[model samples]
Target: MKQNLWINGESVETENYRPLLNPYTGGQIAEVAEAAKEDVIRAIDSAAEAARGMAEMDAHKRADILRKVADYIQEDREECARLIAEESSKPLKAARAEVDRTVMTYTFASEEARRIQGDTIPMDAAPGGEGRIAYTVKEPLGVIAAITPFNFPMNLVAHKVGPAIAAGNTVVLKPASQTPLSAYKIASYFHRAGLPAGALNVVTGSGKNVGDALIADDRVKKVTFTGSPAVGKYIRENAGLKRVTLELGSNSALIVDEGTDLSKVMPRIVTGAFSNQGQVCISIQRIYVYETIAEDFVSQFVEEAGRLKVGDPLDEETDVAAMISAEDVERAQSWISDAVGNGAELVLGGESEQQVLKPTVLLNAKPTDKISCEEIFAPVVHINTFMDFDEAITEVNESQFGLQAGVYTNDLQKAFRAASNLHVGGVMINDIPTFRVDHMPYGGVKQSGTGREGIKYAVEEMTELKLVSFKLD
Candidate 1:
């Protein structure tokens, strides 16, 4: 299949296309058009022009279109789900879940669009003047450039596009090159639902070429990027004045406090670590366990990790699937080897077959280990022991990224303390760090990202708040 770029509700066929493969079976999936720099410029210009039309559209109309798109997605749900699984290497169950979430994203953004009410400023109460009445209004930030990741291809695209369109902002989405077809499919879905031409576009190519052109363009007023910290920093440095919402990588931590039931928590941690082969931003990369139960927890967790079913994502019974590339697997293995060389004990799987790196667990890991400090965005976890709650909190908070944290504790005092002192964006009390429901205001506090991504929050981010004041006649 020739997956060309989408622009102005139309397809742009490129002269060159490259094959994309299913990581699990190493089979040809689809060929994506590699847009040239000129194509990028044309796309940006069209989307920028489309931004005017979108800005003029009433919020209700945009919301209605989104609602219609949501319905259409459900009506053609089977095809959408298959496309996601086929192009992105997402598991069947996860792909189905992602396909269903398109409705949720659109519906949430649609409701948020309708409810985009600006607050009235109490002018008389303020020290200004009794005769003055003041209030605020929300307006779209012109054009939006949405750069999505490959991990959760369909849902992540929805997270960016749903809000961009719902808030009456035209968007040019640049899906990850490795998994661009899913976003292309979504773009087609919106176009068929009567989304005004030029209102939404999709450009598929290398980030350095297409992404840089999109962000650097003055007409593109906002950027929503989900990727690595390095890319986030580059966008922030270059894309000035334009609103930016970055949901970047995280070295998330999970604290298994003393007295928590290991038997109960074992399966949860295993699933959390191995879900999507640990490609998620909030996957539990670091685990700090209380010393007393550390040994028992480590033993049980490793054993459970080994027993997990690993194979093709298309398999209904598969627990873990291949990663996006063979290079990613090798990088993960290298990190684990380095950690082991640095004295971290590998208690479980530390091997890779193709892109499928078996879920790994490390015990008695040191703080200085690379696996604990950096984002090992693979199915390898590092577990260390902490003598006290304070020490555990201290160790977890030392990382540069404060995206998310988890505390497996029943104590009211400890849970609250962990919530306060964790120095992360969101805290899960009984679950691992990978818990995200898609509608919550989710983002990191530090290097992990800037701004939040829930529908309401994204709507707010996509608009400019203008206040008007006038004297009563």
Candidate 2:
């Protein structure tokens, strides 16, 4: 199979193509077009030229286009899920869920298009503004450059592109190199839905070649990216006053209070840690349990983690699949070994077979250990016990990244305290930090990156606010 770039509502074949391999089976899936810096510039030019047309489009027309894309996605749901699983190694079931989320994201963008209005200002509040009438209006930010990650390629792309289109902004999308096919598929859907010729353009290549070009181009007005903190920081530094929204790294932690029922929360904890091979930005990497129930919870977690079937992502029954690359597996193994060397006990499953690093667990790891402090994007989690509730909150806040944290507590006071003092973007009570819907304001403070995603908030981010005032005679 061949996957080409989508520019100006057309397929663009390049002389140089990179073969995309299935991480699970190590089989060739497709040869994806390798976008050069020149190609990326062309894509940007296309989007820049289309911005005026998109801005002139009626909001109802934009809403109808978004809805049609969602309808088409629903019609071909299984094929889209297969493409995501094949390209990114996400399990089929989880890939299907991602497709559902993408559909909902577009659906929400459609709804938000009609509701994108600003508020009227009370000009009379000021001493000299007695006879003035003022209001504000939302306007599109022209061209948006969307850089998505490989973990949830389809849904994450929808999160950026859907809202941008809803706000009547043209987009220049650079999907993750490993998962460009999904982006092209989505672009095709938009074209079929009657989007204007140059409204959406996709260029695929390395971040250095394609992403840097997109970020440097002044024609691209806003850049929204989802990836590591290092790259996010680089974009922020070089974005040159252009609006940027970054959803970066996270070592998300969860606390299990003393009174919580282990049986009820055990499955969620397991899923939160090992889902997508722990590639998810919000996947729980650390767990702090109350001292009284630490041992019981750890034992239950280990048993449950061991039961997860590690195999091909395409397999219907497979619970875990291959990591994106062998290097990722080796890096995770080294971290596990280093943690064990640093007095952390490797309780269960610390070995790697092929590309799949079996879900590993550590007990009593110090906060200073790499697995505990760093954003280890792998299927490994460290468990620690806390004597006091306040100590657990403090421990969870010790890291530089603060995307989201979860606390499972029966006591209302503890839950409220956790919600207030967690020092993260969001605090989940009685649920995992990995819990997120398509419409919630999602982003982090500190090193987790600035600005929020989720459709409505993203629409606001992709637009500019202009004030309008008139003097009454």
Candidate 3:
């Protein structure tokens, strides 16, 4: 297949192209147009010109277009999932789930398009002079720049682009270069849904070229990014007063307290830590088990993780697939080796074959260890024993990332305490940190990210509030 940049409602091919490779097979899947700095500028300018047209669209009409796009996605769900799996090396089942989630995201955006409302202030009750009335209206922030990651390409892109369109903002999307096929597919669906021309542009290229140009451009009003902390920090520093929403990296933690049922939590633990080869931002990286159940948890967890089928991502039964590239697999393997060298015990798989790395389990990893302190972004997790619940919470909070954390316990008070005490953005009770629905106010605190993403919350971020006040003549 040959894909080109989607600009101004047209598929435009450049003289330069990059071969899209399938990480699982190490084969060329397609060729995508390599967008240069000039292409990025053109996309931004097209979006700027279309911004007023998008803003003038009626809310119900916008909702209809989004709903139609969701329908188009559902109609071609299997093909879209296949494209995602082929491009991103995500397993077929996970890719299907991502497509389903993308559908839900657009559906939620459609519903939220009509619900974007602001509050009415009681001017008389606020010590203001009598016979005055005031109300606020939410208005779109012109053009949006959405930079998405490779993992969950469909859903993450939907998280940004769906909300931007719903909020009446034209978009210039810069999808991850490794997996631009899904983004191109999504843009096609938007076009088929009768969205106005030039409303959404997809530019595929390197971050330094396309991404930086988009961020630096004044025409792009709001920037929503999901990537590493270093790049997120760069965007934050250089975005120059533009409304920015960053969903950065995380080394998420999960705590298993005493008296919890291992049967109920073990499956979630495996799925959370190993799904998509653990490339998710909120993938469980650190597990803190109470000493009472530490041995049993580790044994059973390792057993389950070992049972995961690792092979081609196209296979329906494959539980784990290759990383985005061979380089990522090498880095992940090095982290595992480094942790073991630092006195950590490797109780399970720590091997890599080409782009595929085995789901690894480590015990007694020090707090300073690379796997413990940093976002591994691989199928590797470390388990440490904690005697006290508060200590576990403290240990989980010791990192710079404060994204999402999980606690498994039946004790209501302990659950509430963990919920309050954990320094993360969200605490999942009796569930994994990877559990995220489409419509929640999902974001992190501190370096993890800024602002929230869920359909409604993102619409709020993509808009500005204008107050209208009236006084009696």
Task: For residues 351-411, write the lDDT of model 2, one tens digit per residue.
Answer: 8776988999999888888899899999999999998999999999999999999999999
Question: What tens-digit string does per-residue lDDT give for candidate 3 at 1-473?
Answer: 88989999999887789888899888999988988899989898889999999999999999999999999999998999999999998999999999999999999999999999989888888665579988999999999999999998999999999999999999999999898989988999899889998999999988888989988898888899999999999999999989999999899999999999997779889999999999999999999999989989988998899899998999999999999988888888888889999999999889888688999999999999899998999999999998889999999999999999999988999999999999988899999999899999899998899899999899989999999999976
The candidate scoring highest on lDDT is: 2
Considering TM-score, which of the candidate structures 1 and 2 is the better prediction for this target? 2
Task: Report every candidate's CA lDDT.
Answer: 0.85, 0.93, 0.92
For each candidate, give its TM-score against the true structure: 0.97, 0.99, 0.99
- Write candidate 1's Cα lDDT for 1-473 as tens digits: 77888877788898778999877788888888988888888888887788778888887888888888889888888788777776667777877887888778888888887888788888888676789888999988878899999887878888998988888888888998878878887887888778889888888888877899988888988999999999999999999888889988899999998889999889988888878788889998998888899889888988888898887777787777788888888888888889889888888888877577888988766777778889988888988888889888999999999998999988889999988888888999888888988689899988999999989888889889999999996
Inter-residue clash pairs, candidate 2:
none
Q: What lDDT is reached at residue 98 by model 2?
A: 95
Any runs in candidate 3 off by more than 4 Å, and if so which?
none
lDDT of 1 at 265: 86
Give residue 86's error in model 1 in angstroms: 2.4
Displacement of residue 235 (Cα, Å) in model 3 is 0.5
Residue 11, candidate 3: Cα error in Å is 1.0
Query: Candidate 1: which pairs clash?
Result: none
lDDT of 1 at 123: 83
